[model samples]
Target: MAKIDKSKELDITIPEEFALRDEVRFLKSEDIKLFRLLRESMNKIEPAYVATYPPSECGIATFTKDVVTSVAKYTPFSKPIVVAVRREHEIEPYERIVRFQIYKEQRESYLEAARFLNNSHADIVSVQHEYGIYGGPDGEYILDFLEALEKPAVATLHTVLQNPSPNQKRIVQEIIRLCDVSIVMVRVGRQILLDVYGADPQKVTVIPHGVPNVHRVPAARVKRALGMADNAIISTFGLINRGKGIEYVIQAMPKIVERHPTAIYLVLGETHPGVRKYEGETYRNMLIELVAQLGMEKHVRFNNRFLSLDELVRYLCATDVYVTPYLNKDQITSGTLAYALGCGKAIVSTPYLYAEEVLADGRGLLVDFASPDSIADAIIRILDDPELKESLEAAAYRYGRRAAWFNVAVDYLGLFHRVLNRRRLAKELAESAQSTGKSASK
Candidate 1:
């Protein structure tokens, strides 16, 4: 197998003997041989991604890295090149996979990124779209990058608002217009794109957010390792912010503790970077105060740091039940929720868009938003009913098999091939038209 060097351009050469044989055989079967040659060439083309990549400490950045790595490992695609998005000129160290950087506020950076992809061996560009990651109002600055790109582009939307503000709606619409295809992780997001943004249904694809492949382990064993063997552990993990509605979960905890006296709610993860910069641990402090006020300090624990994937998986495996008490009704994607579902923990969540879609069909229980009593009731129901809890976990795990990172990577590669094939056909048609026009004129 030929290795694709990260520091150099992709090598798309075929073996000389094979090429000679194909050329000789092409006299008899030109169409079949050409199709096979084109297919082989398409398989060799590398894809470039534009996203906030790690060590940037953003979820979308982490996601982009995971998908690119998985695609490279599982598919015939060459090593992916990243055009990393930077925040306000702050340069974070990046791995060699990151070939270029685009500053958020610099218009010229977007143009430079486009030119880099256009001139390089990148056959397609995948833009990981999140409004906050880009500059300008509603992240409209990304439009400049898209406009300058000559190659086929695919936009993977992280947030799909059901009822977007006018500017928000326009930004998304324009993004969809500029890209060859728009990808949403949930079916609801696909519907919202078509109905709310008026995007063409044909252009939208639903690829579920990928979750790490986790082997099912007994909760007792993992909890014992984490020093919580005796407790019925419930957990919520992600960057903590007020929007997480942790206060409601804390409020609900008093009831949970009263019923299951040993029930412990583990609040894992650091405060969201944006939230901490502006609010400075205000929400976390408030949650701590609320825990003390409710006299449930013994039942709540906070691991106030970003966890590595191993640590996160260990915590998830230790959990008896997982909870996501989010306040955002229209929240389109939650990496934490997907992780919990993948781990196959019995889950209780408020009916946010992503949760509603994923936890439906008896995969998990859904409760009302911002209602502590509803949350408590759902938690109590799962804790008390052993049969129900087991059923939920089994259903979630079964679904997780389909949403695993490798499978999702395969879906992405298929989409990229389709986009590339479409671009190739369009270019060939334009060239053929030009050639025919010149011959007729002569």
Candidate 2:
């Protein structure tokens, strides 16, 4: 067995292949220990405002909520407030959370909201960047917001497009250029912006998304709830969309069943709301028909409902082999991959950019893109090779423990501290320069 470095994913070294944007390195051996000391010694820091899209019915919204809660609980000094377009999913509204509504028709309203947040006592403004959510191709609203609030801001890039349009590329680049510090969930994400989109490499930071302790129910308990018995289940979780390439997984299923008759393919999560209008259950219906055509109706299960966090964790734990057949190569942060890693489940995914970076730790299997045969081969290889499965499980378990939410929170704190320090330094330099100029004039 290979020696697994138990440091969390966020702490993992960026592969030398990518051009690093920010000078920020994942915690060094000494730095990790230092952060531990700071964690104990430092006073609580309050974040005045966090700017993300409205708390809508989406993963980004859910992640934003979790991050805010974590920041508040972990940082004693900072009680950060959420600046949102709309309060979409408020399971429990906290007093620290504030809302800023921006309708599509009102461009001036967006500026006003930005001004309000800027004028407030917010120390650092953290913006979650996804071009689709903001206005125009290059996130013009982001520019407006940043301009309005000359205060220091950090951006967490959520979606890095694999094939970006000219305008989309420009917007992402502009956002990266303007941000004081840019965060990405994975190194692969940073590379896309720098290498592919030609964005400034010096401003980007890698802060892999963290797993919350809230969803860490016992594996057996979770599996039992899903009614998954002793059968080996290979499941694909998350919103169903064209990019997910779920049909490829379904295609690979027939071949998998030929070898392991008891193998079941569980297609979890709902189709994305954005794509439902054009595709209206067409993909799900097609997969069902394919299962019937392939004569493996019993071997496939379609749990096509929007699963709560608890249920999703149960499904992840219950799954023997998790398959991500996404066609998109630029997908950086996959919630499915994180949950699967959290459960320490063996993964078999297509060769997406993040998959290569993640699987490099020997945590999972990666197959060629858009190839059903390759996908089937990877799945079968895992099932047949006990040693391989054990190795993957062990590696994944080691990785998951470090990538846990608390560890991620610690890394984020480091980033916050860095940005704050940089801002202070810049201010000091300006003041010094001003003083020197006045003396020269006299």
Candidate 3:
């Protein structure tokens, strides 16, 4: 069944005789030891082993993995168990890249993993809250797991819905009630949770997702290496889904080309597994069809595959401007949005919850969602006005400095410490109450 297509096969040939060169950035033994010491110091606290409940495949899983990795590097004392419900085909993606063992099967297995974490010495368990990650139909299992768990827990809400199903609303409310803490990524997301879902603000903490400090290589070299022309490239990276508004971006492309003639739209990343509504090549081919229909065959490019962190950094830096025309109101924490900002690419995004809030600080340009003309106009504004472009780029980099991984790591640690302190106080209170009752009995 594995038919090899010569046309589709990538021609990625490296020269054999070329010697690899190093720029002599070697660290001294003392320096190495200091680095290790620093890394370990950050991770020294005995964190209650965390079991992150995330979807099988998609950005949520990727973000969860990144959080685990960041915690391991900086907060190494925290043992993390990543529980996933994966299909046979999706298994390799996790195995090849994440290198962590994941549990596969139904919602019961997910609950079992949560229960196991609860029974363990884990101080706290963190669930990456998204409706799709929980059980289908009734969504009864998430509540069941929470009720079963005796240990303190936190639920990081990945999506903040504008109009949620009654069941979705109920489950989310129950989650908020069950968990010790609820963390969100943006201000608007927090607002939506409170206003729409009636979540208590006291319970929710707004900590933006941090972007790792990735090296930005020159676009010219990367483009040449990738066999692409030395031209201005615009990129939109993330799994392709209908709610992502990729089709609208493609529609905006013709107009963008009319202004910046040589501009190419490079859509990086693949279809997310959570996007069951538009699975596999269905969404991809539809975008391709739109590209062809718009006569943007030469100008538009697609990379429907998993990209290494280095590759992602390279492509993001290579982009002249990044576009995220998402129509989803629920996308609260956008790693794509963060990645674009971190790279300091002059961005044009729809006024989604995060974009509307974060970009208000003038980090990036914003347009109305679903309006191809609005997207096109924003793209043209950046392309035409160098002053504006530079302003946005500088602002983005400034914002990135604050939103860096190290800073975010510190914030998460603070939250962890607070959660631990709260737990300690609760224990003391319970002991006091019990001791008083014993004295009364005596």
Candidate 4:
């Protein structure tokens, strides 16, 4: 206890002998109950309203679908809806959740989509940005949409080229300038946006690509289920395109087969719809011819179908060593590679931007781009040493757990709430200041 100083004259004073007591306080049981109620109320949140890509054959569509589903688990109050992006000539029955549609090739459609979003009840407009998904040269029409948009926006860039053209650079800069914030899957992407494009450093965030919350199934069990129990499986799964460098994976098969006759390389997924539309199946045929040329027909098989989510997971679980032989060194993101990371398979990949980051620290093995010998040597090392394979898978699985969809979804909600709150605060402050000024003038 400390005695109060009553010696001096004051407007308010304690008694001459008054002393203040200091003691630790404890909450009553009833107060604790009230506190619990208050905490629960604080933790509860309203659902986020997002308008972005819907389910389709595109990998971006699949990613959007996963985002919607995963985000729903954390916020159960309401559901997230979509605004599907379609080809100019396509008309298909979309889900009821799809409130509207935007065509890829029509310039007028972008403005209309913007109008629709501004009038709608959406809280935020999410742009699943890829160069081909939007209209105009280098997707310039998206800039129009963002310009006209009144609602807050968040742009998730699927591709961030290291060396972009003048138009590409301009569009990306405009998007960051217009949107409340922007998201990229890797740190290198954030760095590129800063160093190359001069994007606002504070505007960009790095949230990793999401992967399904999958249970690890034993390779033998899944391999037997797929009728490949006796053979070792090395596989790549993604929409086939010239950029995938499938030919290198094929070329590596002859050498792989020489060491282990039962080793099979499965090339999964159909030709990319965009590639099929523009270039036809020339790339697929070339890969088939190369496989035949090597006399590795039985060892290398192609599953020419679009794999459903379950099917993709099954194939990944069955894979002893997963391969990603992407040729583009500047390629920023790969959904298939993210999935393989999630599945915690022994990954052998060309050192593309994403691979170099995700596969670092022995999480996976990296090889030279378009080099079969490099890929073959990496795969053979994993196959020969069970302990090494286990070590790689263990490390990958640990990392993937940190990047699970659930965590990613929560990160998104956190960012959204922070943004919304800051805006709300600024508006309140401005209104209060205006009211004070009016009162002072009187």
Candidate 5:
């Protein structure tokens, strides 16, 4: 770690830093609690006013809520504010933290929301970016919001496509340019932003997806509580849709059930709102019918409800094997996968970009995409070999402990502190330069 020189010119360019715009490194370097206290005593990083999306049923909404909670743990004085986005036809109740709302299809709504934040005491803006959640072509309306924002901002991009369309390329590039700092869950996302979107590397920070800061519990204990002590729970969770490739997992269940009679597959989650609005429950019905046709109705279960954090965590704790059969090969992040890993389950996933990187080094098993046989074989391998399963569980648990939300918050606040410091230094430099010019004239 490079130390800052206090004697350096305060009115000129700030000194270069070995670790800037990130706190993950800081947490890893020293004791998190002690270092945070030390920094607070030396120079208190005040509680920043952050405006972001409020909690909802969607992935991005839930993500924003969790982040706000973790950030609040450090900044107890002023909790982050919310600028929740509402779908055109949806009218869900929100918490009081939601100071403003942006209607998805209304162009002017974005401008108004931005202005609302600008007028508030918000020191910074936090964006939970996703193409589907925002309005306009390729979610270009977010550009308007970011453009109108007057405060320092950081955006956490949920999706990073390797081969994005021209419109998507434009929107993401603009987002990177507008924000003070950009965060990605994986290094793969950072590379795509640089090589594909031509973003500034220095502005991009890799903060692994934040998981609940909970320790691994005994699987048997949770299974017994759920009244499935005799069964091996194979679970997949998230907003279910065609993109989830759940049918393939169900198709693989017959083979798995034949080999291990106690193995039961659990598809946990309600249909995605976007999918439900247009297609209804057509896709979910298809999977249910397939289960019947295979005569494996008893072997599979569907919890057709949007689970709360507590319910979701309870099931996750009981899970023996977690699977993500998503078809999209380009997906850069999966909250479901992160939670599964955090719970220390033996994960069996398709070789999606996020899975490939995180599940590397023998942490989890990966099979061919959309291949039921491959999926079955991998699940069986884990079930059949106790040592392999234990190793994967151990590795996943270790990584989960490191990537927990509290540690991730350390990185977030670290980056926030850096931005604030830079702004202060720049203001001083400008004032000093103006004073020198006046003296010369006299």
Candidate 6:
């Protein structure tokens, strides 16, 4: 037996003649016995993931890392290989697990990636899909890679638009066609795929966004340790941009502080790299101005840096209430909101597609989009009613347990197994047909 070094790229080249001879030999051998052994040993093969991984400061990157690492822990697959997607200017050191890097702007990189996967020992490939991560118009460059790859692929969609342009619709439909299965975080996204994009309903699966398995800790203890003992903390954390609608949250804070004098809003996370690149702190500067103009300087604090999972968990634990005042109503997935729910925090959010579903059945409160008054009222209501806050937190925590990374990883592994089984069945059928034709000719 050979030891597979996951850190290095797999060297699985096959000579054309050797491959043909092996196929003939395989068909002539005891087919049932071979099929049974392959089925039994399927669990031993590890799947590779294609995505933007850590050393790249993208949400999908962090997400791919967590999912792959967690799945490796919970399943028989031990060493998860990563084909990391990289931007042209962003060069950073990657861990040994990253087997290859796909340059975002390089068309040839996609073809190279497809070749790498086809030649690797991966049972299947899991692609973490986000439009902005790939190159070309509407990220159509991913099609080249998906089309070239010979192995099965399972794509996890991060964004599913309700109404997409023709080009956008075509891109998604094509990707769906290429993949063995398409996974979305919410049912709404699945519906959009079926109704809007005309994807095969049977091909889509809903797996909730995975959250860290953090135990519910007392808010007071965490707050006290963080030197926020005297203030009632309200927090929103993620990569910040104009779409976050943080200005509305800041506007809502003055009223919140008036009612509960010690109430403080903690805005955690860095300005989004893309936003910062173009606008250069324009949105953030506007938010700061809004805070000052409203005379809520004492009530608002900004932590302008990307937070580690531990740091994020601590902040969520310390929060009395979590708020997401996103302007985008069609947002289908939010990792920050999912984390807060996992930590069992009372939440207030705009009526986005994700929030409407997750906060249903009394898990959290929803406010009208862009309405500061609604945001303020919701926060005050949660803070004033202790029983309500407790109930919301309990409900969220119960739901969060189901979305914990371990459980989500299991769901992913099951999907991967299905794709692999389907691939094997197709190959077997094709080989059987080939053998039958040869016999007829003889």
lDDT of 1 at 145: 96
Candidate 4 lDDT for residue 188: 90
Q: Write the per-residue lDDT of candidate 4 for residues 1-442, one digit (tens) a residue.
A: 1233344212211113221111101222446775555445543443323333544578888888777766655654344557777876777577776777878777788788888878776677677788777778987888888898887788889889898998898989998999889999999989999999999888999889998766576787677666777888999999999999989988888888888788999999999987998999999999889989999999889999998777888889889999999999988899998888888899999988989999999899999999999988898898999999999998888888788887898888787777677778999999999999999999
What tens-digit string does per-residue lDDT give for candidate 2 at 257-363? 88987788889888876678687988778878988888878888887788877677657776778898999887777877876887688899987877778777789
Off by over 4 Å in 2: 1-42, 48-55, 86-96, 214-226
Q: Evaluate model 5: give its TM-score.
A: 0.88
Clashing pairs in 1: none
User: By the lDDT metric, which is better: model 2 or model 5?
Assistant: 5
- In order of appearance, the predictions have TM-scores of 0.89, 0.83, 0.82, 0.88, 0.88, 0.89
Model 2 error, position 61 (Å): 1.2
Q: Per-residue lDDT tens digits of candidate 5, residues 1-442?
A: 1233444312211123333223434653767785566556543343323233544577887778777767766653344678888876777688887777889889999998888888877777788788988889977899999899888888888899888899998888888899888999999889999999899998898999988765677777767667777888899999999999999999999899999999999999999877998999999999999999999988899999998766787788888899999999999999999988888889999999999999999999999999999999999999899899899999998998888887887888888888877878998999999999999999
Quantify all predictions' global Cα lDDT against the true fold: 0.87, 0.72, 0.71, 0.80, 0.83, 0.87
Clashing pairs in 4: none
> Relative to the unseen true structure, what is the C-alpha lDDT of residue 431 in candidate 3, on a scale of 0 to 100?
100
Which lDDT value does model 2 have at 270? 84
lDDT of 6 at 74: 50
> Where in model 4 is the C-alpha error above 4 Å?
1-55, 439-442
Q: How many residue pairs clash in each candidate?
A: 0, 10, 4, 0, 1, 0
Give the runs in model 1 whose Cα sits over 4 Å from its true position: 1-42, 75-77, 437-442
Model 6 segments more than 4 A misplaced: 1-42, 433-442
Over all chains combined, what TM-score does candidate 2 have? 0.83
Task: Identify the superior model by lDDT, candidate 3 or candidate 6.
Answer: 6
